[model samples]
Target: MQDKLSKFEKAALLLLMLLAGIFGGLIRYFHLKYGFDALGLAVRGNRHAVILAALFALITLAFAVVIVLALTGRLFPKDAVAVGTIGAPTILLSALSALAAAVGTIVTLASAVKQLSVWGMLNGILFFAAAILTVPVVRKLSVRSDSASPIGTASLIIVFWSCFRLIEVYRTVSSTPSVSVYFYDLAALISLILMFFGCAGYLYGRSGAMRVYLTVAAYLFFGTVSLVGKGGLCLSALFSGAPVAMANVTDVCVYLYGFLFALAVIPTFFAPRRADPVAELIQAAAEPEESGKEEPPVL
Candidate 1:
């Protein structure tokens, strides 16, 4: 039985992602900038432990659902899984990330290096190099082959940045790091390692980095929501009179990648599955021979 998703089905899922990702992202950004939760939903009184556990459960369940849907051809035909197509959103995001990273880093480095001292200057340099590494996003507009290097490198930089970014929020529960904060850092580290191998392997002409790229994407998703509703701990403290770090200006690395990859996975992975030619040939040959045989009498 054919089990491919109709356009409407695909649209509905995109809408869900839009609500959960894009709209939810805006709320997080707003809270981070303002240092206050308008909705008053911040977890308090040592309950963050429970919230962290529930958060992982939700993310794990969401990932599993996406996997099952994609693999079973519910999201797209399994036949088309091999030959994926590019979408506009992917291109737009690629362009935006590249430009934002390049321009943001350059501008900030120029303006803030004098005031930033050595550590900030180093961060500015590192971030600038990382930004430059994202060239493939704009130049090639795809993550296949050695081209994955840029994104792989960028993912590593994001992991490095998150280390500094999440330090303030790493609350301790029973002398252990809070699950929400620590888990995200752990995911970023793992993705960084995977992306390194994926990119290195690709350099040797091996394209074993697709899954690694997805992992990075997943980590980015976590990063986008890491500070949501967590007042006073947001990396971006625009309205709270906090001094913004130079790196924060170029943080499009995490935000932009998260948005792009989450959506890009859809078009790059989905297609109308075409029937296997060899299988069709075999079936055709077998069918003719079976048809040549006499039919059994009906009972």
Candidate 2:
């Protein structure tokens, strides 16, 4: 394979990717707090907010198109990255995110822990059960251990996106549909699709690992930004003595899933240091009938 990108092009691309991440994180923060349509009629309609929404919509749609095209076998991203195994930094981040999330959960529930209802119990059970099932994701990244099954990961991804983001999008569209809300609807739907692909790709760990990494990063970035954006709206409403558009439990779960995606990134980037397992995965991915031959790593 040839490295076609000039140094400047590569640098520019990295910067753009980083910016996208920052913006997405902001949106996630807000979205989690203010709930669906929090950014729709009130925010997206504002002239200043237009720039924010426009940038996010552009990023979401752009990545969505690329991933969809690639999935359909029509095109693939040009930039090449070879991730051979999961790394310590990724595991550390994952651990930190999970621990922080746990502490946050306990604190929030402390006030009402004794009055927990069936809904709360079910939600907690479902959330923790899903988290437990994904434990092997990062743990096995270093050794190419098949402890985490793709099907399990897929189920979790689909369930979360469907139950949370997709339903929220639906509720947004159910109301009066402005141009901005329509745009929001489309962006939300596309992002859910991207999230699904990104999560599924993490377990594949063969070729296109860099693509998986970028997709997962983009998904988490969007998730983070949405949560932050909603939080911004909710806090303002709280101070002004207005009803806050908050879904505390659900929003936290969504944020934790974003963190999970961040952890899954470990396997997407760092491959096993040994080539044997890498070769086996690649062979199975690329050609099962052909003789097992090692292909040079992508640089």
Q: Highest lDDT: which candidate?
A: 2
lDDT of 2 by residue, 1-299 (tens): 23334233333443465567556546544443333354444543444355556777787678677557645545433434444555666666666655544543453344235556444444444445444434454454344333456653544544463354455545546675345433443443355456545445545544344555555556554554544454455466667776322434344444555545455554444344436767788878878555467787999
Candidate 1 wrongly placed segments (more than 4 Å): 1-49, 61-79, 82-88, 103-122, 135-205, 208-213, 216-220, 227-236, 246-253, 261-267, 270-299
lDDT of 1 by residue, 200-250 (tens): 454334553244334444544444454233222434354666655533434
Instruction: Assess candidate 1 and give its lDDT.
Output: 0.46
TM-score of every model versus the real structure: 0.52, 0.58
Worst 10 residues of 2 by lDDT: 1-10
As a whole number from 0 to 100, the lDDT of residue 9 in candidate 2 is 37
Q: Which regions in candidate 2 have their CA more than 4 angstroms from the true location?
A: 1-15, 24-45, 68-82, 100-117, 141-197, 200-211, 231-253, 256-260, 263-274, 277-299
Residue pairs with clashing backbones, model 1: 79-273, 80-273
The lDDT of each candidate is 0.46, 0.50
